[model samples]
Target: QPQNVIEKIVQRYAVNLPTPSHKVAQGDFVSIQPEHVMTHDNTAAVMSKFQSIGAARFNNPQQAVFTLDHDVQNKSEKNLTKYRSIAAFAQSHGVDFYPAGRGIGHQILIEEGYAFPYVMTVASDSHSNMYGGIGALGTPIVRTDAAAIWATGRTWWQIPPVANVKLLNTLPEGVTGKDIIVALCGLFNNDEVLNTAIEFTGKEGIAALSVDERLTIANMTTEWGALAGVFPVDEVTIKWLRDRAVYLARTQNRKHERINDERIQDLVRNPLLSDSDANYAKHLTLDLATLTPHVSGPNSVKHATPLTTLEQQRIKINKAYLLSCVNSRASDLRAAANVLKGRKVADGVEFYIAAASSEVQKDVEKSGDWDTLLRAGARPLPAGCGPCIGLGVGLLQDGEVGISATNRNSKGRMGAPTAQAYLSSPAVVAASAVSGYICGPQSLHPTNPISKTFAAFHAHPQSPIITYTDNATQTPPAKSAPADVIPGFDGTLRGEILFCDADNLNTDGIYPGKYTYQDDMSPERMAQVAMENYDPGFTKVAKKVRVNDILISGFNFGTGSSREQAATALLYAGFRAVLAGSFSETFKRNAINNGLIVLEAPQLVSDLRKAFKGGEEVLTRRTGWDATVDLVGGSVGVGERRYKVPPVGRAAQELIVEGGLENWVKNRIAA
Candidate 1:
């Protein structure tokens, strides 16, 4: 059976399969033990779950990587305590740890060589797709999945439908990988590749892209609603590995044996590629030459427009940012510096810049790009995920218009929901800052033309490598006995339906980014803020609902971020089940792991929408149609109509009855 890159990678890592052929198809669920699993500041929460699963020690310490990137700017005692807990947990478990200010966890994995060609890496972050830049199959998993891997060194993942994207022509000058992705999001705003894996081809065009460019494009595939966006392992990839090996060896004073040419050549000789006869669910062709500088705006990544269109709109900007795991690499920084070389940011535009990692910061500093940005009135922030995840300074104030290089601009993600944010490349961000409006690099009118060539690696790195080894010989602790009765789940459930008639209702709107790092938050508090971003009065209406009430929404519910809290918050808010037209795969998994019932009933959702005629009355009166869900029968009865839905599998029913994957794993360990 011929396979694409994603399928091939899955086959390499899949374990405990039933067949000796080791063949898998799309939509097939298989157990996999990935080469690496990454978690950021959420490590604290994941650590709590790991311990709760009755696992005192890591099953495989080498497979776990912890980094403290998010919420690094919050020096509050609570944040510090949480960071300390993460550090202590990593040390005691013999896991590799990167302290705060190291960089975004995804980038750290790449810079340190953990995410290389042909490897399978999963992070508890939606942007883990960035690893595909170097030919790795990277995807996101919820935190519970992370905990399961820590306890058992394995978890199940479904192979998503794969899409093949072929690049036809080289990008024109001043166009970037960011522009290409923004264009894709804007043009294909109809969820063309939703929940699908993407494989990029076109030998000439792909070979023309730099590693940083590839990373930018692959990173934003999350915004495009793809599970993974992988590029081919060609000479560009092999050369990057060679350069990275040299840079790491020289800066860390590591022995060459750690990453030598012989090892690299082994990968080069046996490159990972899709078979010529491989099947793809969808095919898309993009001409890079036809693309221009583009920006995705205000509150949605799908609302993309060319720079010229935005310039004509004369959208004024009060805040500008060049940061995030997506576009803060060395090449992106240099691109911005090229535009800001002899220019100053326009008055009233507060520009901020942050490198993807501290090492990237050092690299740009050596190339003089760092000082150039500083002299151009740009404030330098710590080398962490500042302002990108809605933390730290430079957040957009209410009614302010901002332009950023971050991957997402979902409502209330960067600041107040009323604030407007536009996403673009680093050059566009710099130019917009200089013009005090949304524009491109051509607006700067620099003496020298912008340089297209960017150095792949700079050798001014300084970070201590830390590793912990667990040598304890203590006996494994006994697991608690399984519960006699599983709560909240039965053959039949009845509840009032709460309707939210909006498509692509993102995770940020469901749980809000402001409370993402609050590990100590109680379920009561989570319920209070549930859907606060989407509807400010949601909690008020939810408060009047009975326990086990059902929630119904439009298509693509829970579309953004890999935060499990999106589902857990609704669970805490008394929603026993969520029925939507469709679901984001990660959100569905997260809900299932947390024991929240999720169902797909497009016709039912449409019928409900027609019956309620927009849900305004439902919200005002605190009343809606009642629903009776029959799990065994796979039918939902609302009002006088009955709709058929996919039956819940026995495995899923067992997990829901057992109160989630954590409890199920605990019972299995005890058995």
Candidate 2:
């Protein structure tokens, strides 16, 4: 039977079915028993749910990996405690554990050979889709799903449709994989690829990219709101895996063996590929010849602009970073070194480099690529998610501008919400670092000297401080307006509709990661910063509204990051329920788990768009709009028109009645 990559993978791996159907197909709701499940930084949240359910032992310890990557250098006691808890849990359970500063979870998984072709893994991190680079069917799940997997070794999924994109020609010199992807983002943006597995095909494109380059593309699929971005297993993949195994054996003093010749052949013979006649919801063919270096400007991932015209935009940088999972591999460093080998970074600009993994750092050090970067005055930070999710190094001060190789450049991505961030290729970042502005490698002139006058900005008081915080007092969780006592979906809800038209309303934008690390924050405190970047006045608007007010948004709402606070913040702000055109898998689980109602009402969302204006108007409009959400009847009424939409399903409705996942699980334990 002909099938796309998604169907083939889902059919083979799906487990635990209803009596009517054991076989799964596209759009089927099936539970998956993943081969491995990874949780990092958010592992504590998973354990919280697991313990609440009275599960003493995880069902599959050997198949689990716990790591601490986000906020690795704990500034507060709370952050340090979370890391210690995860480390202790791993030791007790006899599961694999990687400590802080080792690497990002997804990158470490690939380096250690857990993300091999045909393997199915689920992680509690949005970038779990990064494993798709190795032809693995990896997807992100919420903390509750991770807990469920811990107890029952299974979690449910709705098999998504495949969006088959064929790359037509070889990439030009100096045009990196990041350039190609950002250009594609300009065309497709986030909405086009929402909940679809993006399968990249065409021999020319696949063959042109190295495994490292492919990883860069795969890592950013989350930004596209893709279920997973996959490349078919080929000779390039086999060679890369073999090379990594040998490298680790030689360098890390670990028990790493090359995949057996027979096993390699078996992998080759049973390669995961999309059938030529595979069904795709959308088919797009992009030629490499038409591509140029591009960047996604500050405040949004989909704002792709060609590098040639960046000078006209006057996008000068206060800092430039070559790090993050998207482009921090050994090959990525080599690309940066090529531009900055002998050139010095501008005086006012702070250029930082961080390797994806410690092993990748060793590889660069051995190759003298690390020395090259240092000679160019690029400060080398520890191997991890350094400053990507606002950890520490190269954190932007308020009003500062930055160009980074990280995936998303939404407002406050690096550190301060007032600062700006732009995403680009490493080569572009290197050249920009030297020139003190956004430019491609070819545009950098050798004779240009470092700027003598530093940019006017307040220097960070604690520049590069890596130590434990002393006297950091913890605060009791502050209570807020109690959840509007929602009776189990007997139906009618009338409230003002807070309309938002932006697709891919990410969690990072909803609740910044910087605040999450503080650990002493109350629900009210989080609510203050809720959607702070998206709308600075959101908290004030939310305060005036009564409990259970309907919050409506565009596609892939609450996408990006697995932090449960994204849902909790809105709940504390007194939102009764959330209605969206669609939602991310993890976001839905987190919302349902945290007692924040999320409903996928496509028809109602469409009707709301027609009623409301687009662009800044959606953010500006406040009142006079009313919505009647009829859960029992499954329709939404605005004025005279009534739009039919399905209610939140049985399981979610039960969660709503129980107040949250914790209450629901506690009730189950008591029963």
* Top-scoring candidate (TM-score): 1
Model 1 accuracy (lDDT, Cα): 0.82
TM-score list, all predictions = 0.78, 0.75
Best candidate (score: lDDT): 1
lDDT (C-alpha, whole model) for all candidates? 0.82, 0.75
* Model 2 steric clash pairs: 548-576
Q: Evaluate model 2: give its TM-score.
A: 0.75
lDDT of 2 by residue, 131-204 (tens): 88888888887778788777767665656656777788787555678877777776676377778778888888
RMSD of 2: 11.2
Clashes of 2: 1
Q: Taking the tens digit of each residue's C-alpha lDDT, what string does model 1 give over 62-89? A: 9999999989999999999999988988
**Model 1 off-target regions past 4 Å?**
256-262, 451-554, 557-581, 594-659
Candidate 1: give the clashing pairs: none
